[model samples]
Target: MPNTQSRLQVRVIDIHGHRGARGLFPENTLEGYAYALSTGIRTLELDIQLTADDILVATHDFTLSTAQTRNSEGQWLTGTGPESITLTAAELKSYDIGGLKAGSPYGAKFPDQAFLDGVTIPTLEEIMVFCSDYETSSGAGSITLNIEVKSDPTRPGHTDRAEKTVDILLALIEKHAYADKVIIQSFDWAILDFVQDKASHLKRSYLTIAAHNGEHATIYKGSPWLGRTQCLSDDETIPALIKKAGGNNWSSLYKDLDEQAVSEARALGIGLYVWTVNETEDIDRMIDLGVDAIISDYPSRVQRRLMAHQMHWLGDC
Candidate 1:
């Protein structure tokens, strides 16, 4: 059978909880993931940072971010505080990243998110347990974990090398027995290559962010810019560039996407997943795009929108 994760039956597609629905909950915390599933998101999109000892921990920031996390003493970190690579898994566990100014357009909405003291950064093992148990309790489908191994090939001696990062993540997920339940992704295509090379069974996505090509890049090789880097410019089209840059699978910003683009991508067999959208309108737009899946901060909003829109669509049909 075809992969069920690739599409919806009628209207739209799966909703991936962006860092565990950062706007409604906390970014990249177990609480965030749980709350997102409770609110009806299917996939939990999170980042995995390896510590000094190689424990895979779910968090978005490369450093201990002051805007989103707090120290053991209950003081919120205000800037790029501690580098995650330097801290051990034990020491890293003492910090909590419950409430900060969430992010753009969202920070203004969720004003009173509770700051839970003594909440530690969760290991991949912990998150797996949470999801497995959550499935039993909530009857949700096998929850997908998109763990971006945060390693840069150029920036050595920072996090693990691409190979080691993939190794740590693959081992941890295997220990949890989620080999078929995970999709590993990264902006670092080298890491993607590494993970795909190591574990060919695991679904992999190559992330395309704003690259730094000098002029608005033309067709580098008559393809969208997935691997061939582009200059990060607001003037240029990122999703189109990513399409031209091509890969096995593709992910882009929700705002930069449209229906025609999605269809074009799908015609080429490129699976579409967009990022970090939190509003109902954008959620509606994503459904219209017929995207394979979406990463959003308010998974609840996405679910509600899809459910409601489907009913409306059925009625119209």
Candidate 2:
């Protein structure tokens, strides 16, 4: 960790644009990223999925989602995800993601979200090139890429073999020559281990959930992983599990953390990075928690909040 400062002065920071600023724009689309950078945010958070042609594309869900996606046949994907077994990038591009599930108060939130026809899914390589070119042109604040490898053990062989997933993803990241400006993170610790072995220099951040992101969700009634539903388990109270999985950075849920939790993570040699923090109060509370980084859907707000804090490096004189 960097030296502790009495005044908050972090020249470099980790404020990730969750799903390219999902709250402001359509989630996971290139337009969202463009908007995020416009807000003075320095980094983007993205998700990856493997196509049938072994290409890695930027996506949130394994299949299409009603929130931001439609099917290849001009219809909404309201059914089982298992049916989308063989969607190639080209094939998946036929649908209109921006058209679906509209007219509700949900769409009212972002009335300005642009809609484009025939906009296909962008491969990870494409996103990399976009970021690279943007950096070259803008030359403003340095931007970091937080690309999540959207793979899981439950599906087992749904996307690609572990080796193949790494190969395609690593190649895409290397293709744009963004090896340095990237932070590879994942829910699957197995993927993190594989990434660490492959590129030792690569920075790794692990995701925790209720039990994972140092949040209470692990003990919540909704979680299937709980030891006994309707009753919180003693295992849920253990902080070691989060420390062990967080590697060097503990990215936990926002509500489940306090100042002590932040200090505990630091004490365990695990720094802090909280995820998916969207609401205003949540953002404020997390800021007070003094995490190393906080991933939020609204990076603009987080940036503004951080700028208001005191900076020791500037000097009080």
lDDT of 1: 0.68
Off by over 4 Å in 2: 1-13, 71-74, 81-85, 103-117, 156-160, 212-239, 242-246, 310-317
Tens digits of per-residue lDDT for model 2 on 172-235? 6676677888888776656766776687577777665654544433333344332122324445
Error of 1 at 75 (Å): 2.4
- Identify the runs in model 1 with alpha carbons over 4 angstroms from their true place: 1-9, 101-112, 153-160, 210-246, 311-317
- Model 1 per-residue lDDT tens digits across residues 113-164: 5555556689888899999998888875678888776765445574345568
lDDT scores for all predictions? 0.68, 0.65
TM-score, structure 1 vs. true: 0.80
